[model samples]
Target: MNSSLSIRSFAEYVEQFTSLLIDYSPKLISALIILFVGLYAIRIINRLVRKIMIKRELDPTLSKFLADSLLWALRLLLFVSFISKLGIETSSFVAILGAAGLAIGLSLQGSLSNFAGGMLIILFKPFRVGDTIEAQGVIGTVLEIQIFVTKLITGNNQTIFVPNGILSNGVIINYSMQGNRRADLVFSLSYDTNIKTAKDIVMQVMQNHPKVLKNPAPTVAVKSLTDSAIILAINPWAKNADFGAMASDVLENCKEAFDAAGIVTQPYVRESSKA
Candidate 1:
């Protein structure tokens, strides 16, 4: 008698489940169809956006970032629609989603800040790939502009990943923007050295350099008079791409020229010992 009662309960449970399935089957099928259609539409939209970005010649990093963001946003919307189609309450789900999003956002504040910074950088055109910039105490060529960080390669061949948040907020010295750069150099001469003679030598050395700009003309003049020496300022203009090499060449060439001209630099004077 007890086994018969158990069998009857199991059959009743199965009947109830079958009724539920039959009642919801149409909604389930419709939701599935919508999901498939939405996904296909999203793929087409994504492809169209990428093509437009390419046609517009937008930055590759910006294009990829925007594409992925749009794809996920569409997928999220489709998910909400899919569940709502099957008689699920959406308001509570949306609220829970909002709460979860808020929590995630709060936890990833730094990363979000960097992401925003990257967007700002891409929009403002402060610098670009191949630009030589000095920021965050690093001077390097920009290799790639990513969604979170900017890649740079220094003169010493060191690869750096600088966070976009600080880089955008901080002072950025884009050496490549101005097309030209002036190198500020100073040379010391002995008190006995003739100012005019030393100036001529330095000026000639700078003018002879191939990378130095001639139109702006390099300048050599007395900067200051120290107790033991005369300081001469040597300022030269060069193309941005040539600035570093030109400055280095000028310094080296000037030293050799000074030696050939028998120009004496500041003499070392040892301090007297205290009694």
Candidate 2:
């Protein structure tokens, strides 16, 4: 009798297990199907988003970031839905996820700030990639604008990564924004030098330069009289790309002209009266 009773109990346990499986098998299958379909949908959506960003001419870094973020968010929601369909309560799960997200966000305050700044930069567009800019005491051409940082290639070819937070908040001087830029140059001359003669020489040099713009007209004037010298200010306008070349040419040509005219630059003096 004892052996018969043990066999009967084992049979009863197997029946119950079979019943449970029968009840859950369909739900499990449905969850699997949802998971696969959801992942495929997320991928399609990500691709579509990337195409749209490209169409809008959005920054490549920002476009990829936004697309990936959307994909992950959609996948997470699909997972929660799948769990719910499997007869699981998702409110508690969502709450736990929310708590975790909050903790992570709090811990990454600086990163979050930079992300926000990057968003602002994309939206407002104070500067764009390939533009020359000065910010945070560094001047360089923008290489890329990422979610948290911006890459710059300096004139010396050094790569610098500046945090977006600082870049967004700091003053940015975009040298490439305007099509043209003015080169401000000063040449010191002896007080006894003929101001008219020096001005004529500088103006002639600037006007004859191919890179200098002729529309606004170059200006050569006495900027200030100092104890040591008379400061002749030469302002010339040129295309943004030609600014450096134009300035260098102006300086070199001005020096040669002064030498040809037998002009002598005054020595440094601290206490002499202005001419």
lDDT of each: 0.91, 0.90
* TM-score on alpha carbons, each prediction: 0.82, 0.82
Candidate 2: global Cα-lDDT?
0.90
Backbone-clash count (model 2):
0
Specify the highest-lDDT model's number. Answer: 1
Cα-based lDDT at residue 34, candidate 1: 97
lDDT tens string, model 1, 1-275?
99999999999999999999999999999999999999999999999999999999988777888898899999999999999998899999999999999999999999999998999998887999999999999999999999899999999999999999998999999999988999999888887688888899998898888898997889998999877778899999999888889999998998888889888765534468999
Report how far off residue 200 is in candidate 2 (Å): 1.1
lDDT of 1: 0.91
Model 2 residue 222 lDDT score? 89
The TM-score measured for candidate 1 stands at 0.82
